[model samples]
Target: MKQPLLDMRGIVKSFSGVRALNGVSIQLEKGEVLSVCGENGSGKSTLMKVLSGVWPFASYEGEIFFEGSQVKASSIRDTEVLGIVIIHQELALVKELSVLENIFLGNELGSFARLDDEAMYRRTSELLARVKLDVLPDTLVRDLGVGQQQLVEIAKALNKNVKLLILDEPTSSLTSTEIEILLNIVSELKAQGIACIYISHKLDEVLSLSDWVAVIRDGEHIATKAAADLTQNDIIGMMVGRQLDELFPREVHDIGEVILRVSHATAMQAGASRPQVDDVSFKLHQGEILGIAGLIGSGRTELMQCLYGCYDGQYSVNIELEGKEKAIRSQRTALQAGIAMVPEDRKRHGIVPIMSVGRNITLSVLDNYKALFGAIDEDKESQDIDDYIARLKVKTASADLAIKNLSGGNQQKAIIAKCLLTHPKILILDEPTRGIDVGAKYEIYKLMFALVKEGVSIIMVSSELPEVIGISDRVLVMHEGKLKGDFGYRGLTQEIIMNCAIKEGA
Candidate 1:
């Protein structure tokens, strides 16, 4: 048999005495693509870290072999010398730097005495062309969209002459078209004899891009099989240890009378020719899961921000609650008016990472726990925090652990818990499940159902059509800051939503 291009045997990794990877192993041939699928904390990222030398050689018990030779990588740089590269989920580009500058930031060409700008530019152009990104070499990274930046990351990897590229949740934030472009780029890379270890929660993308699929559950490698032989159901079963019979657990409930209405909501930024949200007016009823569906730049998030009193630019709106006109000018005012929002970018806007999970959950209601002389009622606060953590099923080693220590899905649930603590009549979830795994997504969907059944209105802005259609009672489609269509869930379809989003409602 031909020797495999890469082999990993008996990989065992632990974190703080807890095993995160237990004797997991995988093998790949030249020009092949392997996808690792698992839940958020199922050791997928841990294993990848070990392979890329982020955990270093002595940190884990593993034997790695590449090109029929034993490998020992003490650092990421050591592995990079042998053509191993990893692109993390959170992009590592300097926003202020130009494309060419970022690509050669650490690994500049030419002699140590001086840099070679001309050579770097030419190489950057070639790398950009290879990745199919149509941008000038001098364009600033900040001006590029998320999709463009992702392509730039790949170009950086190519510049390293990467033989085995490991992508961790690469398409988690990309639009459908962007995702298609990236998948095509991966196909091209494979044709050039570059092997890849792709990790993501998106099962369809895995099945389409990979030759083999590896499933891990709670730090244990379950199985590996040819992608052609495994369906999405099979992968989900292995990842979660059971068949997730329904991807979306839709619930039936009655939508009450309109509790809130907005008229002529418009938000505009400085020097921008157009409003981000242009005269979009809508009504949200009690116990209703009103979904806002649109493409990435369709102003779904902007509209929600307007309602939540957090839009950064100038805004004008007429909001009514229970037939009474109200003014909501800030997040504090919005919360006081019985409206709460869980933002799109959670790491930046939702939680204080250094704060404990219990404290983060109680952040919105800190005043509610105030005692005499402005002292915090620690006993009451602790009880309430415990209750919310249990109620939300936020899996944490302990409530005292920093919120950053939890996985993306658990952090999201904690954010939701914080919102629920406000006892808001309306809740806004902007891309709440953006990078979360399937198991967590299902749990969040179930929680949404439970919330709506209790008369807490919800406005969910999502880029995913299936999620919007499956969990929403009513769908509102937006396009270019305009409300294009409104349809009842009884007969809603993704095709109808997209048609309205691309043009006008038909």
Candidate 2:
């Protein structure tokens, strides 16, 4: 038999005393694409970490073979030297650095004694062109949008002479158009004989890109089959160990009188020509799921930030809570006034990754757990934390485990739990299920219904149009920071929403 380009055997990784990967094994050939799919916390990313040296050799029991030779890599650099590269789910680019600087941050060109700026600039330009990213090499990463930043990361990867590549949820923060560009880039790379292990919750992309699909459940390899023979339902069934009939489980809930009204909200950045949020006005009712839909940069997030009192720029808003005009100047004020928000970038703004899961959940409501002379009431706090953890069905080894160790879906649930502890009358969810699996997204959708059934109004800002149409009682479309169309969800479709969002006067 011909030797495969890469082979991993008997990969077993444990955290503390619990096994995350149970003797998982797989093989990949050159010029082939293998997509790994699973539910959240199903050990998909863990398996990739083992192969990419993120978990390092000797830390786990596994045999890795590259080009028919056994390999033991101690660090990511070691794997990179052997033509293996990985782009993590969470971005690793330094915000302070420019695109050219980030692409060649450590891997510079020229002699040992001196660096080559001209050579580096030329190579960066070539990489940027290869990735179809129309951006200046000297452009700062901080100034770019999330999708642009994602492309920049891809550009960085293409700069390396890689034989095997790994992408973990690369399209999680991208727009649909940008997603297509990325998919095309991946196809181009496959044509160049680069083997790729694609890990994502998006099964459609998996089917479209992969020559084979590998499904894992609870850290165990389930099955590997030709992508041409497998359907999305087949993959989902393998990942979750059951058939999920409905991806979007929307329930009927009563939408009552307007509990909150936001009028003429406008947010302006320091150097921008126009406001981020332009004269946005809307009303959210009791027990209502009001979804805000737009392209990523259409100011949906900015409007929500303005309402939550977290917008970085100058903004003015007139809010009426329960028929009384109110002022929300900060997050504390928003929370105190019966409003809570689960921000867009969960890793950056929602959770403190270093903190324990239990602690992170109760962070916003710490004052509620205070006892005696400025010390936390451990007993009461743990009880509340446990309750929320159970309520949200967050899968973790222990509440005391660092939240960073949990899956992306679980981390999002913890952030939602933190917001819920505020007991807010209205909840703001921005990109609530950005990188979550289909199963987890269903759970969150069900939870949204449950919350609204309990009289908690919700305003969901999402880039996904199907989600906006499915779970929303009403939909508000935004374009260029302005409200373009507000409609009942009864007859709403993605086309109608997109038309309104893209065509200014539609």
TM-score, one value per model: 0.96, 0.98
- Model 1: lDDT to the true structure: 0.90
> What residue pairs clash in candidate 1, if any at all?
none
In model 1, what is the error at residue 80, expressed in angstroms? Answer: 1.3
Q: Count the backbone clashes (under 3 Å) in each candidate.
A: 0, 0
**Residue range 1-506, candidate 1, lDDT tens digits:** 88998999999987777788899999999899999998877888788889888899988997999888877888989888889899986788999999999998889999988888899989999999888888999999999988899999999999997999999989988999889989998998899999999998889999999999999988899999999999999998899888898988997888899999999999988999878899999999999999999888888888888888889999888999878888998999999999999998887789999999999999989999999999999999999999989887887878998998776667888998899899889999998887788888998899899999999999999888999999999999999899998999888898999888899542
Residue 475 of candidate 2: its Cα lDDT?
94
- Put down candidate 2 lDDT per residue, 74-146, tens digits, no spaces: 9899888898999998899999999999999889888768889898899989988988888899999998988
Distance from true location, Cα of 316 in model 2, Å: 0.0
Global lDDT scores for all candidate models: 0.90, 0.91
Q: Report the C-alpha displacement of residue 306, candidate 1, in angstroms.
A: 1.0
Best by the lDDT measure: 2
Stretches of candidate 1 exceeding 4 Å from the true structure: 504-506
